[model samples]
Target: TALAENHPNLLASRHQLAGAYLADEKAIVILKKVVEMYETLPEDHPGRLALQHVLACVNLRDGEPERAVAILEVVVRNAEALPEDRLNRLVSQDELARAYLNAGQVKKAVAMLEDVVRIRKAQPEDDMNRLSSQHYLACAYLAENVVEMMAKVVQKGPRRLVS
Candidate 1:
């Protein structure tokens, strides 16, 4: 139904629907359309980032981390420069870090995740987000064999329950 019309309001919803389509054929088609719509929008338009994020997720799920990384790099770079959207910038950075990890760019992933941890920590003390980002950063450090960084992050997080 979405493929038949280019309704601006439906673009976001279609992107969500695309995620449920396990078959790449349908998903890619819908995603491509969404990307096209986003491309036509202003460069700073939030919808562009949202569509790009969705496309990156699809790429990652399809075993195309490199492609995901490409999309997220732009998203992260632009989001980071937007001082008004600090939270969006941090979230985009977090996603880009995950994409970097998937692409085996461990060093870049660690750096980006570190920034996320720092930014989250500076917020009004949202323990859950702080701990989640810290945990992810710690895991990234572990993957890179950087025990020191992993130890620092783990120490800052809440103690785990011993079974």
Candidate 2:
């Protein structure tokens, strides 16, 4: 039954249901509907940001990182709008950086990751998030063969873990 879904509770059932679609060929269609619903939801509605975040993932998985970049850039701009929602912005940045890299735009990827590293370093966040940005930036540096920078990041070992 539709009621028996991946999301454990009613609170996230709709979003969770979307997850089921994420795994199926039907994902694209379901995602389109989700984007529509998401657009109709009120600004600052409790679940809206999460929904948009998921939609961005769907776009990426559908092999449309450029589209993901568009969605994520908007999400990034709103990072400070919701402190609790900042994680989504961070995630989007990570994906957007990769999208740029995949598109043969390593310079842009490195630039994006550089900004990510700076923001994450300046703010208080979960240790994992800090680690993620550090790792991503490190890889971006390495990919560009910025050996000096990569070595520094490697030496640091996830800024939080280093300290």
Candidate 3:
């Protein structure tokens, strides 16, 4: 709370506190406040996008896949509009794929993951993004047949795979 007061303008600080709260039972309350703060920002503001992404994650964590899919759809659209090389764009796409899977949209998730895989593969061979994207793509494929295959599932990460 002190950080929130001391750095009222620092969205990241508030986001950190919100994330901490989101890890526990108070997630609903904390996420609501953070989402509200983010919604007040301009559409193009990075903080708004980031907050929307966080809300999407919270929605998923709360077992509300439909809500997550809804939020991720907007995030994915905005991310796709950015340059192809932008890390946030790729990360958003990946997250959207995860949301789709969580929402039981397997084919849709596969399509998005395939797109990410293709894009990453087009980058330099040494790029970690290429490697990790390939891995996630594979995992997504496995996820589609998980019921039959009986395999463990892997979730997407929020961090950029490449530097």
RMSD of each: 8.3, 10.5, 10.7
The candidate maximizing TM-score is 1
Q: What overall lDDT goes with each candidate model?
A: 0.78, 0.69, 0.76
Scored by lDDT, model 3 comes in at: 0.76
Question: In candidate 1, which residue pairs get closer than 3 Å at backbone N, Cα or C atoms, i.e. clash?
Answer: none
Q: What local lDDT does model 1 show for residue 47?
A: 81
As a TM-score, model 3 comes out at 0.74
Give lDDT tens digits, candidate 3, residues 71-116. 8888877777788868888888888888887887877888988988
Predicted candidate 1 versus true structure: per-residue lDDT over 63-96, tens digit per residue: 8999999998988767766873276777677778
Greater-TM-score candidate between 1 and 3: 1
The local distance difference test score of model 1 is: 0.78
Could you tell me which 10 consecutive residues in candidate 1 have the lowest summed lDDT? Answer: 1-10
Candidate 1 Cα errors over 4 Å, as ranges: 1-6, 22-25, 123-126, 146-163
Once model 1 is optimally superposed onto the true structure by TM-score, how far is the C-alpha of residue 145 displaced, in angstroms?
Answer: 0.9
Worst lDDT run of 10 residues, candidate 2, spans 2-11
